[model samples]
Target: MPTAIIAEDEDLLRSELRRMLAECWPELEVLAECEHGADALEAIERLQPDVAFLDIRMPGLSGLDVAHAVSGRCHAVFTTAYDQYAVEAFAAGALDYLLKPVAKARLEQAVTRLRERLRLSETAPDIGRLMAELDRRLRPQVETEQRIRWISASVGDTIKLFPIEQILFFESDEKYTRVVSGEDEAHVRKPLRELVAGLDPEQFWQIHRGVVVRAEAIARARRDELGRITVELRGRPERLKVSQAYAWRFKAM
Candidate 1:
């Protein structure tokens, strides 16, 4: 039987994919499942499965990074929530990509393609060009107006607004995000994913799946004996854990 691995950050989505795969490709064996890019990379390297279903935007290495690193080694089907531009790029490259919420019909189509490629022993898609096109579409353009300027969070019973510059970090709570400034902290209804989309990427860095910190507020990044990177904010005693996928951002510093 063919072997496969699923890499997705969201637990529910990952489970859904597994369920769909069981129904669609009952003969295929799922070797492993990973929730972060780094873990997925490691699993891919160790298991070397026949196929990998990777989520494009994951905490740690990202599906693109994993696919690039393991080029030609396995059949890769990317899962993404990106727009039509990315989908067009995938189609142009003859790459297999599944849109989010992964409908049964679409997934069946992807599985059919996979079976054909495997049966004929086709080469992996040229991920280089596809990556370039994806980068061009996903990278933030020089539009200052699009950057979020102010953030409103609830401080007890009152709502307070803080300038974007004053904010030090945003950490995801159960259903809301906790906004922290120098000494003040407040909770907001906005999720981390939505906040990340509006925030300036250069100014704010997502160190972990649940954390986004201001670049200026970052005092230093340190790696432990195990080579796990963690960031310390300027005045904050808490050291934030950085996933391996995003460790490259702190490599220079």
Candidate 2:
């Protein structure tokens, strides 16, 4: 049986797509339904679904952004309401898409193609080129201004700026998030959720709900006898717990 996840900001559209999938592809197990692109990306990494139905324009990471970030991982089926010019880009590419207010017949066609692709065990195509083109044409004035460059945190008596690149990991509680850098550590009022929006997905991976660690800082991952996994970091004594949901990152091949 195939597995999939749906991502659409609109409640009705998300539900409608799920209903349509059940109708057209009954055997397709929906691993998750995501209302935000960041959640969708995390779900894809965590669930390892066979297919992802992504909304082209999402709040934080757009569908194109997610597709590019997880290239060659899973098949992507974009759901778009782009102008005719942008729609033409999809038609000219190898990717599949369903227009907004997706018609049943079109979705059925997409389902059929997905089944065939899975049967053949086709490699997922890299969407870097398509994303660049689509991004350029869709949001010309938009740049990645949301990515955090610095974390201004208070030291003993003064505030210090930690470059986003040098940060090792972030652990959060209900009220505050702890920022650890190479030189020092500090606590801020922001939660992990809001900080995720500014952090680059490729740089910071959410190992646990309350923790986000730099991929480069990871030294090794060990699974205990109880089957729980923990991550050890370079030059750091603390071992971060990898939750079951994110344990897929260290799965044995």
Candidate 3:
């Protein structure tokens, strides 16, 4: 029986996959399961599973990074929802990629492929070409309109949705992304990259990797003696740091 490990962040989806695997591929033994890339790496090193099911995107290290780290130790199957990355995965010569909300038929096909691979003594698939392809196309593409389709945010006991234009700035503090508007702030799950893709560049400038400030709300910009740049908002005393990458945007302030 081939040993395997599953690495994915979502709880319900992970449990569902476990159930499916147990039902469909009873001969395969699952050595471990992890919620993050870091944990997955540790598990792979310790258990040395024959295969790993990894989500392509995770909090700390990306799945691709982890796969590269554990090369030769185990075969890998990438699971992701985004279709654009499919081309890149193929270029990497990966074993297979299972799209999110995995279909039963697809899972069966993947199992068949895995069985065939184990029968043959082929090496793990090459993924460097795929990663390079991702590097070329993965940059954020700015959209023209300002809108918020769905929101994953908290407001007291209930989740709330405010239009994108209502947001003044996005501030990152520790683990959470705070959406500030007027005098209030709401916590949202969408990361800076996801948020930036939805926001219009003409209205929102990434003043710092940690911040996306509204273009109209910037009151002024000032530089400290040490050559550090800071921005002062209209009503907030807290100054936002301006990294060198975004220094050009502060010239107007």
- TM-score of every model versus the real structure: 0.56, 0.54, 0.49
For model 2, the local distance difference test gives 0.78
Q: Total backbone clashes of model 3?
A: 0
Off by over 4 Å in 3: 122-253
Tens-digit lDDT string for candidate 2 (196-235): 7677767888777688899999989999999899999888
Which 10 successive residues of model 2 have the least lDDT summed? 85-94
Task: Rank all candidate structures by their TM-score, best first, as comma-separated numbers.
Answer: 1, 2, 3
Model 3 agreement with the true structure over 1-253: per-residue lDDT tens digits: 7889999998888888888888879999998889988899899999988888888888766576576556546777888887445434443335778888898888887887677666554443765565445434532232244345444688779877766776788987677788887766788876775676566666777777679888888888898888678888888777889865456555544
CA lDDT of every candidate: 0.78, 0.78, 0.73
Candidate 3 Cα lDDT to native? 0.73
TM-score of 1: 0.56
Model 3 steric clash pairs: none
lDDT for position 107 in model 3: 85
